[model samples]
Target: MELRSSLGSVATLALVAVIVAMLVGQQLGQPILLGFVVTGSMSPTLEPGDGFVAVPPVLADDIEEGDVVTFDARELQGGGLTTHRVVGETDEGYVTRGDANPFTDQDGDEPPVQESQIVSVALQFDGELVVIPSIGTVALALQGAFGAVIGVLSGLPGGDAVADGNVETLMVGGGVLLLLYSFAADLLGSDRGGRDRSRSRKGATRAGLVLAVILLLILVPATASMVIPSGVNEITVVSSESPSSNPTTIERGGSQTVTYNISNSGVFPQVAIIEPASTGVEVAETTHWIWRGQSAGTTATIHAPDETGVYYRSISERQYLGLLPLSVIVALHAVHPVVAIAAIDLVIAVVVTVVFALAVGFQPLRFRDTGRDTSVVDTVRRTVRKWL
Candidate 1:
């Protein structure tokens, strides 16, 4: 029972902290993701119960050999948090090993994970491990109870898959319940007592400001920098054939016919137009095409030159037909990482700021007077604070 109360206290504290952090993220104009570790691979570095901060997967491959990282380690037999050192890379794939392990991991019989397998990398500071050893096990037990609730809801007489927005609704409702607990903590667990109410309020205010700064600068920026770009990433179009064309010594207006297939696998509505990038290359007049919109799948003709020995724009690959639209043929376009992430982060920051302002404006009143409480309040307050 003491453990349960402690767990509840920890959870309530973490929740309020996270929400406050998220609010700070919006003020600084960034995305915020509060993530917890579920694995013990990092051990003393990050106990299983502790929460770690993560920046998205953008420059994760850029993570150096010794950096601690959190990535989509699902293919390594199980999924969830994995903190490991990037050991080496062969033509096949990267090799990774945990910090405390005696030996490097043998590839788990699965194919060498491609670069896309990574999710995000977490950078933890010196000492934030607050969850007791394997405290998450108890948290998971609570989560398991919640899972049972979901299963019960799902199989009820006229129920649907807990997917009909009940999950989020329940979460918010649960948060509302927790919010009362948080206020109760503030009212009762004042490290500084009634004798020093002014000091407690002052400390709380300062702590709030510091938490705001950390959320805005570090946490929000990192999460926004990752998630917002993901939408844009989904809208890429690659030529089925390698988008690369060799430098050609060719004459103007001389036709060099190259055969290529244009695949628009992205969600955006775009049609491939074979435009001439060089003075020597010409757009083939025969190559006019209309894709039936983004999802209908359209194939376009790209011409390569024959003279001054024309370079044909032929990019074809039958081998990558399985992925549907995202082919091995990559187009060359230069966008700096800083500029790209900044653009999306700016947009997300705007949305987050608006919502957060509303939440602040409508911040709920913490408590209300129930008319019949004065006599009981002093007695219980004295009892609770142990002030005889």
Candidate 2:
């Protein structure tokens, strides 16, 4: 029961923190998203009942044709909001059209969308739009409930007393209270003879020193590599076709040659390797070396495996210090990019968690041998002070 309570408390605390941060950022006029889809104008791209996670728009010059954008359409027909892809750009603004629509918005009597009307760009992950389906339904339900309550309050004689919008403040306060409650609970557990009583001061000091050394060893080289300047390596695929000049299509048990143009723009010469590995599928492997401030052209023969599926061509630049190689892998499947990055992230998280647990575990125990009163309030205060 105690373990369950502790886990529940951690989850609740994390949820409250996230909510509070979102609300605070929204109130501060950040480009934080608080929108839900109600229309299907962008069907096949964004469906009805989808949730939007709005990101700050790129510079107007950076907004290229075919980019999906969300904007205010209050003055347009149907009068609410709209998100569409940019079809063409004009001197006036952007010519927007929905992916599933038969014609452009201009064809429907709406003028070209001005840059001033643009709100934000819908965020994309792994080259695909980020969307959470069915979440909009929950948002709509909450909006309806709030509207009904506000309507009732407005109908009352002393409406001003209840109609004030303090929801953000209330949420922030609730989050703070939740944090305090969690801290108090931890203190209470510690006071109830939950601490180990056999550890010595010398042992604790030695354990702490070892933990610090381990952390420094892991962090120092990583930090130094970032600060140090390494040669810049650039790679561009010149062609992926064999002698026939036709597009290279890898069928079952086939081979193809891909030519690449590699360049080095820094003081030192760089080596780039094209290694084939199974990141969901098998890819062809090759390598090349380029001189400083010069370019090199090389070809690699890629062999397709017997089983047919998607594949990847991983281009990696080898660094001098022998750290992890910087890689740019072209994949046949888009989700493979997200999966590749997420796998690396998961490994780092696991490593950090294990190291942290070991470091904390090795710390000497607090025996609670003193005769000083271990009352709930006193324990809570001590815990708060220690954390602070």
Candidate 3:
């Protein structure tokens, strides 16, 4: 009898909470987005599974330090939101850190989280997150599942690692259903003769508008290559179209300085990889070589020694993203001195990858590592900037 009463009380509390949540969600409308505490952002202060009643600042004045919060993370992109503790604040924005995180965040000045970008904060804390530490992994797997399904449904076939036609159909069908529901809700009203005609017209307009939006989403990514000017390689890598003259004297053995006029033939940034023609020509120990942006370059060292009987710099394959082989991998040639052509391609890939890493949550080298890793089975980076 006591246990039954306890269960009844719990049920009543849950019902009240649900009613309150619905009221809050309806009143706040867009700013108050719902989320659950998956991990310990507040740590001892807050635990897992504690569902948060997140609300964007009613005004910027509402923001204060120590309030567990959620905001947009730009580099994370794609509707990504991070909920963390506001350790400090600047005139520009709030300084946030997760309880689990030792470092505050990557940038000295955290990205000024605009009010428009904020999702709601948790006001309602029940217990903790659903899955715990293992939850993030599950979320990631779900994303991969959605991404893979989306990839296949769009008619562009993706990797065999995740090829399920049913999954693809489900994702697309679900999206269509959601859009139709939204459109119908917008057109809901009385329908009688003239009123029915008006409703039909409104419904047509809403459906057309929704379909147009869906098309825009699909076409924007699909036709992005056309408008965004993809594969428009701005960087010119000079592969020795003309073979070099063979010289076998010590006049060139010592540290010899030569000027390489690297001109940016394309509209994009260019990169060059210079190395010895083969294992035969040694780039004398402590031999210095480097190139800057324009005609006059800087100081640097060559990556690979003389091998493959060729020395040339080509735009990183990564620059040519549209081209399958050339964009990611130049060529797979197993030659002596381990001068693999694909390895040379990596030097270009790495340089471009290192530029804007700090802005994003991930370090640049780490990201370049993905493409570099894929090629690792067959190659390595042969470059002037060895690890950059």
Candidate 4:
């Protein structure tokens, strides 16, 4: 009972968090929502698979130079949505650049970014932008699964002739019939088992309530996503030239400085990193890039490898998903790193429902070592109790 209740409580709390976050992030219907990094353009800072929350800018003019901001690409004849840093401010607009690039967006023959083109500013913590690393890969994987599922369905019995509409109708009808049978059986058997019947009905009522809440919460977002297909944008990444270590040759065990220029061209701010590819090399002073509208230089002191031959250093991007998911893996493991990427936010609520069942006082957790009582009524009680 305790475990079951904990599961239900977790689900309810998770659902509330998502709903509230969506509501707050999408304020004014600007479509500024949570998203993950899909490209390595922000490499060394925000690498592929990172996730971050994006909130719409309230005042475009308030957008300062050096702020990492997301904007429409059309303004520069670019692709879909692009996040880059504001490099310079002009009477015309904002000049942007990618940290990995050798030149600014304007140098590529594009005009300065205007305020109207701005979308959301990446969320920040302690004056530094935070991103959840490697979560976006899950969404990418789900897209792959969706295609595979379609292929499997198409190959079934009737092949292309197997209509999904027909299958759905049949499934719905079968569910309704099964539910009716269960209710009838419970009612008919009640006279012979009064206590059992009462317990069963109570369980059924709680189950029904939980199901209803879930459906109600889901219906809104599912409908919204369907209604606004354009609101969904693919991940975009931009990259620029990063610095390499100097004095290519160094005596074994000798020390040297590796300097690199890190820039943010996308609106999202990234934490620029300089890490050695091998344990033989050690670096110092790895700092977070503010990505404040311009390119900044980062330097790290490192000890050369004792072994001879070429070695490499990586400039990487990291994401901050906040403490809950980062500190505790299972807390946000719903966005599985390996599969089911498509489930994203929706599946999280479903996953947390182990707590939901217990939270609403529907089914109390059972931990007693008492003899087992695994009757069908107890199994089906949550739904039946409400109607009874």
Candidate structures ordered by TM-score, highest first: 1, 4, 2, 3
- lDDT string for model 1 (102-124, tens) is 65554553333334444445554
Q: What is the TM-score of each predicted model, taking all chains together?
A: 0.41, 0.39, 0.27, 0.40
Candidate 1 deviant stretches above 4 angstroms: 1-41, 44-51, 59-61, 78-81, 107-111, 124-142, 148-159, 163-388
What's each prediction's clash count? 21, 0, 24, 53
Locate the minimum summed-lDDT window of 10 residues in model 4. 231-240
Model 4 regions lying over 4 Å from their true place = 3-33, 58-61, 75-78, 153-203, 207-388
The sequence of per-residue lDDT tens digits that candidate 2 reaches over residues 1-388 is 6588669767876655544444433333333454445678788767887766766442222566776776656446665467788899864457888888889987776666655456567766665877868756765554455456556765789765544656544343444455566566656556434343233231123445445546656554443332223222222122222233442456556666666555666554444444432121222334445567876666656555455543333333322211223343222112342333333334444576587776567654343434653543455466579999
Give candidate 2's TM-score.
0.39
Name the runs in model 2 displaced over 4 angstroms.
1-31, 58-61, 145-388
**For candidate 4, lDDT tens digit of each residue in 272-339?**
33343223334454444434465656565545455554443333322221112222322233333212
State the C-alpha lDDT per candidate: 0.42, 0.52, 0.39, 0.49
| Tens-digit lDDT string for candidate 3 (51-162) | 4455444322365666666765654323456677777866434677777778785353345444434555545334332223333344334445655555665656554423
